[model samples]
Target chain A: MTLLSFFNYWVVIILMMVGFYCVIARGNMVKKIMGLNLFQTSVFILFVSAGKIVGGSTPILRDGVEVYSNPLPHVIVLTAIVVGVAITAVGLALAVRIQEAYGTIEDDHLRDDFDEEDD
Target chain B: MSPNELFDLLILALLIVCALAIARTKDLAAAVILFSVYSFALCLLWVHRGAPDVAMTEAAVGAGVTAVLFFYTLTRTGRREK
Candidate 1:
């Protein structure tokens, strides 16, 4: 297969990089959560794309369809999606608590507060 | 390329754009909305890849419930990044 044939994987890599950057470089707690979601979705796409078969139909059985895409990856991604949402909810709840405790959700300010507490 | 390949390329392009926009936007609420758009584009890609069941779950949970959670958090924590 040519390089172009693997375009989906290339997109996944780009997306993964973007999400990684957001998580590491951003300071806003909510933005970090968004970045984590972005990263997780890219992974989901990777698995689903890997499972696709050319000239295949959906996993449902039918009269004339001879091949169906692998259903295992789809099942895995479905569970991951649900778990990802739960993670997001928990992360946001933590952000709310952080805001309540610290009065700001910016990472630098939180660090400064910690420094003050130490001294 | 055939039409199917071309369509796949288009959706992937949209996904990348949505992701970049989410990373670049300063407004937390706008980023949340962009994330929903990204999730919907992903769901479309899942459908195109012949996994309607996963696509349905993504549409309902990824684009629907998650966005609401983000919005509720935004209301509590505030919207500006700084």
Candidate 2:
């Protein structure tokens, strides 16, 4: 069997690991958020790709067009994208407040700030 | 391999490169910009896969709204990682 048979899944897995590593390894809060975004986007890609069929037509119905791709994933991803935006907004707001409190968004500095506050 | 398969692989390669760039950048602003490029690539991948609706959502939310929101927050919170 050729690698193409399963390489698409491998791509998504690599993205997942990259994002997960960024979230765990990065000290910057914004980088962490972007990592989360990348992770989520990879999953979205996986889902949308799963819904594709070889030689499938676009979901739109028209004359002489058959074998339409799955529309369910599209609908699901639409809602998911909105939720992701909401989550990002809230996360950023929290980051802003954290910045105001500690004057830095670095995880290391935040720890230092917390320790200093305990004095 | 057909042209379609080759194009898909090309986009996949670009996505991986962009993801690494975003993850490796120390500057938060640069990472955010790279992320916009990443999202645009993702939208293209989806469009290539025959999912225009998902592609549209990815473009609008991922590239447009997310980038703007990050910039707005960055301007207030400052841009450096440390």
Candidate 3:
């Protein structure tokens, strides 16, 4: 494999880890969502990168063109972007409600509030 | 290795380091900021991979819109107690 290709793969992997770490370790709802976004973005990057072909043109069908980077990844990314935005919107709305219901957004604090109410 | 390869590696290392820091941070805002960094790094990676459209989406939605949403939520909610 070429050095450039090697670098791209490693970068995507590294970014993925970072996003996962944030989602898993952070205590706040918003931070968790941010991590989730990062994770999804990294995945999108991975898909797009995997679809690339050296010296390939846009996936438009053309005369005498035998090689083209897969357009499937591009279409997938577009769909994913829309989904990600929708998720973020819903998550934010949930966060707002959580704030109203518990007067706090922190996961630990929200849990504590729930326990107090249960008691 | 070529300069481009070296740069990519460096960016990858930075992305990992930022992610680790985000995970370790107790402050929610800081974690979100680190997450944005991770997203931005991934956007660059996508561009390098020749997916400019995907990279653009990542930059705009992942790093921009999502980060703003996170910050908005953080400001709306209180921090965890000690």
Per-model chain B TM-scores are 0.98, 0.94, 0.87
Winner by lDDT between candidate 2 and candidate 1: 1
Give the TM-scores of the predictions, in the order they appear.
0.97, 0.95, 0.78
Clashes of 2: 0
DockQ for candidate 2, please give it. 0.80
| Residue pairs with backbone atoms closer than 3 Å in model 1 (clashes) | none
In the predicted model 3, the residue pairs found to clash are none
Q: Write the per-residue lDDT of candidate 2 for residues A16-96, one digit (tens) a residue.
A: 999998889998887888888889888888888888887787898789987888989888888888888998999999999
lDDT at A60, model 3: 60
Q: 2 or 3: which has the higher lDDT?
A: 2
Real contacts retained, model 1:
0.89
After superposition, the stretches of candidate 3 with alpha carbons farther than 4 Å from their true spots are A2-18, A55-68, B78-82
Docking class of 2: medium
Candidate 1, CAPRI quality class derived from DockQ: high
Candidate 1: stretches off by over 4 Å: none
Worst 10 residues of 3 chain B by lDDT: B73-82
Give one clash count per candidate, in the order shown. 0, 0, 0
lDDT of 2 at A117: 84
In model 2, which regions exceed 4 Å deviation? none
